[model samples]
Target: MGAVTGDQTVDQTVVVAVDGGGSKTDAVAVRLDGSVVSRARAGGSSPQIEGLTRSVEVVDALVREVAGVAPLAGVDLFLSGLDFPAEEEAYRQAIADLPWAPGALLDNDLFAVLRAGTSAEAAVAVICGTGINAVGLGHGGTRVRFPAVGAISGDWGGGGGLGSEALWHAARHVDGRGPATALTEGICRVLDVPSVPELIADLHFGRRSQGDLRLLAPEVFRASDAGDAVAGALVDRQADEVAALVTACVRRLDLAGEPFPVVLGGSVLQAGHRRLEDRIAARVHDVAPHAELHHLRVPPVVGAVLRALERAGADGGALARAEAELVGTAHAALVGGVAR
Candidate 1:
């Protein structure tokens, strides 16, 4: 599509923005005037799990499908597994090689949450989805982030971590090695196994993928809500981890006393678990009284679109319009049965 300016017909700047996460990837083709032309969704495109080439292929396919015949003005990719500078640069080079776009802006997916949650100059975002990670933007463009490569990076507490912990406690309870808890029964029931032993056998014999364990994360919350002590402890620990991440970022950027936004996104955090939210709020407030906690309400792909527009030198009016349009489009998509 093209726009008419004065007596000239100029091709409208189109940006293909993508938010690729560990469980799903979302992409949108949008114009400089904040209009969404197309939207697409695909399965997880995490390079850590799908390999770099495969991950790139998945996102590229979605981008191509959304962009159609429009020449992209910019491509903004905020993806999971681009945790380090090296990884980000590698992806940047790969994206730059694509024929559709001139070049690309790449960063860890957590920044998508940061941008989507707030427009503040200084902010921190903690994502607790299938995995956990955080990023902080401080004064004078200072930034902070974690490797977030799982246990090797000392990362703990995500859907995967919580699920693994549930299984561990269940197995111990079954084998008389841990205290009795409802997770044993809850997990067995959720997985449709007759008992913990059978569940163990199924997981061990390849009847079920270990990754399915992440599905049990919600069971942890359910059990916690039902007054299961073990489950409650796990939930509490998850909150502590989230709080710790925010605290560390606040301290590192020396924003502890300054007003800043702490954006919380990802399935685990957005699940509306009362205890977890309460604990996180209480702990974060104790450390940084001026910090504001913002639970993201829109799909983070909106941030990708915003970043794309910003890169294109869009004015304030364009940004405001884009945010409004993106938010409305996201809501409509969600209501129409598209999963975020």
Candidate 2:
């Protein structure tokens, strides 16, 4: 239930949605009846990750793909990407000039998460993925951010950060600068290599992709559970780092001593490490005893769509009705639609 684009045209059958991320861009175009009309993907498009030109290219490709299928001269778009004042302004200008109908609405991605929650007072969210950032919506749209500040500034909790840490330990151990940790031998074992040298050669020679390094996070977690001191310490440091960030967000917004919503996102926090979440919670409790943290166990895109609906003045009963219809629609689509 998005805001009705100026004069609903017969040419406005396409509804454009995006999950613009650091690694890739995912878009879906659906009909008014919630049927999957088409889908498309493009390279990374986050302004913080990719420059304006590249981000525009990705958005252009997505728009074309949606329009190609629906043949609609106009569309309704809901997007959640890297959000800053300049990025928001740039994206709004680009999309508004698309001549694609109904224009677009630009807001911070974390705002979407805040909109998804049922609470009215305050809700905090921390996304530990390619980078780390925290947001707290204290009523209205009041919010604060942790400002990831890149890896050099000690933001080591995301998938990228953990991967970097694993490699750092492996490289140090291999070079005899640090004691031989299980990661050094375990990684060599997985790659079917005789030694760390061969693994280094494969990595440096471009035989392994970026994902190859990210996949080792789970292995590190497993090895830590198996009593590897170095592996355990790596994960411990990660949880501690994220806990500090979340606590800072809560305290900065004066969300103390309440049953406030402390939401967690990112694969590193949700899927990559479950025990890490428990540790983070423990640390947070130690800092803010009255804070209640909630883990979102569902796809964030659903939350994003709901946020769009909320932004359109659909609230309370209106929101509940829309959620009922959309959830039912999504279920039917998943059941009878093409294998997605």
Candidate 3:
């Protein structure tokens, strides 16, 4: 949405871009001169997890902070948990009355991953953070995506899922219901518990929390590195799931024979775990032998800036400057300032 205050054309050069995720929301105000004037962060703004009203409040607060006194020429929002067009529309309507309405562009955060991973406007992006989702954009505006609404949408493999799988294997191993493996000790040690039974009981009786369980995901990778068979298997399964998603998107976009970028985001993939990376690369090569892999090292919010630059009619020089400047400064904004 474009905004004009009174007779003067507001500096349409200033852009407010946001990358809203399940855990946090990052907002930035970039001047047309290629400087990031302000950057702020807030809590989760995913309507699915935080509810519509709360999600709007969180986004509004962060955007308001970064925007400061500037009248935004463009506002680009790439968010997670907006699975359908309806959810996007709901969010659009909710923010329609804000000062930066008509010039706003809202999209799935997967697209942000696409932009963050490569300079191309069209590509495939897969996020394997808390959950797994993929998006593929082809030439001439062709688009393909999954619902990514969790198990009900035939989706699996994320940090949360991996953590739960580790616990499942650990509990079964302890009770003699499955193959015994190092995960029994590894998981218990990671959780600082005596045994799988006690850990399970703590989680079940509210002594521990699901968030604690989710933190076990990185431990799963570590255990895999240590040659824990159960952890290795779980990691292999995650690699399989990510590969399946990336390949499916490639096939859907019919880019099987071409050299296209497969941008990987989220902690699971970006962590650069060699075992998982090798398996995913092998599977992807099997499907699209020429597919390129881009592991995102910069914050995904860079995508929002890229999109905003495009919207602001920024020249190649300005675009390059924004990318270089934003890449350096956005990290400072990512720390703290998560709104309650």
Candidate 4:
């Protein structure tokens, strides 16, 4: 059921799909029969995280690993950490040497989340992982997005942001600048340090890398589950933040009062941190009352595959088979796949 291009059939089509994110990249070469030809992974390639050159290097390396010497019917890339049109264009130009580049399409990774989460013509997706972002696609090709480039873009709600908040409250509590709470001692306990001053000194002097701070995100969830007031507040704030993004996307796309899906993706959201999930669901319901909540269980690369099939003009039946095949392989690959 592929497009009738000189009588070519669906089984003759090939697809090279890529999903690039802040923590890692996943590339898969899928055939029209819904069987995978190759799959590969590499480190983070987001231009917003690493510079353009390094981002290109990371993405290209993975693409080559999966797509070497393969003829393709189409290529689709869904990437995170691209903040604006210029950034997407720059990345597109940088990766133009791939065999299928002339026929390829590039899009934001949140769209991948949306595609992976639902088959609906209109939906919203919010990814809360190393960083946070959202995108909405409505009927008739309407699209909405955010800069998602940190506070300057007025965006937030990722593991990194949540971890930073946990540290901020703990530090403030130690200095009598904030309310006393379990986060102060919980942070010290996790770090195995004696007190807040010592930890602050180590962090300030670069003795402890600031990047390791994200490790505290799990501790925050744990504290919240244990009824820690400070941790609970931070979790609640994150829920509100994500719900706000989804609400904005829903409203902007005119999806209000509809039973459209609001897909959740990334480690922070997919972890099913019960309290956070409940809060986010409740918050989203408050605004978009009929929005259905879906957690993306398959890897985002499945979304990329779906896009590739769409580009190839494969029928919906082929899409269903391809998705199922990709989902089965995704489980096995995930044992070794690097997830953010």
Estimate the Cα RMSD of every predicted model relative to the unseen true structure.
Answer: 4.0, 6.1, 5.7, 5.2
Clashes of each: 0, 1, 6, 0
Error of 1 at 59 (Å): 0.8
Q: Can you list the residue pairs that collide in candidate 3?
A: 1-101, 1-102, 1-103, 1-104, 2-102, 2-103
Per residue, candidate 3 scores C-alpha lDDT tens digits across 1-340 of: 3347887653444788899888889998887756778888888888888898898888888878888777677788888888999999998899888776676888898887777777653578889988889999887879988999988988888888988888899888888899887777877788888888998889899998776766788989998899888899999999999898988888788889888788889988989899999999999999999888877778888878877877788766665566677675443332210100
Mind giving the per-residue lDDT tens digits that candidate 4 earns over 1-340?
3545676644534688889998899998877666677888888878877788998787777767787766677778888877689988888788787555786788888777777777677888889999898888889989888888888889776878987788889888988899887877877888788987898899999999666667678889998999888899889999999999988988888888788878899999999899999999999999888888887788888888877777777766656677667676444333211221
> Which residue pairs collide in model 2, if any?
74-100
**For model 4, which pairs clash?**
none
Ranking by TM-score: 1, 3, 4, 2
Residue 195's lDDT within candidate 1 is 92
Worst 10 residues of 3 by lDDT: 331-340
Q: Pick the lDDT winner.
A: 1
Give a tens-digit lDDT track for model 1, residues 116-208.
877778899999999899999998999998988888888998889999999999999989999999999898888888998888888899998
| Tens digits of per-residue lDDT for model 2, 1-340 | 2335687643335455555666766665544434445667777677666776777778778867765645442343333344456656767676665655354555555554444443455777777666666677675667786445576555666666666677778889888898778888777766566877777777789986655666577767888888888899988998888788778877787766776767776667767466687898899998778777665544444454444444444434533443344455443333211111
- For residue 218, what is the lDDT in candidate 4? 85
Q: What lDDT score goes with residue 111 in model 1? A: 79
Cα misplacement distance, residue 84 of candidate 3 (Å): 1.1
Q: Give me candidate 3's TM-score against the actual structure.
A: 0.89
Per-residue lDDT value at 139 in model 3: 77
The 10-residue segment of model 4 with minimum total lDDT is 331-340
Q: Given candidate 4, what's the lDDT at residue 148?
A: 84
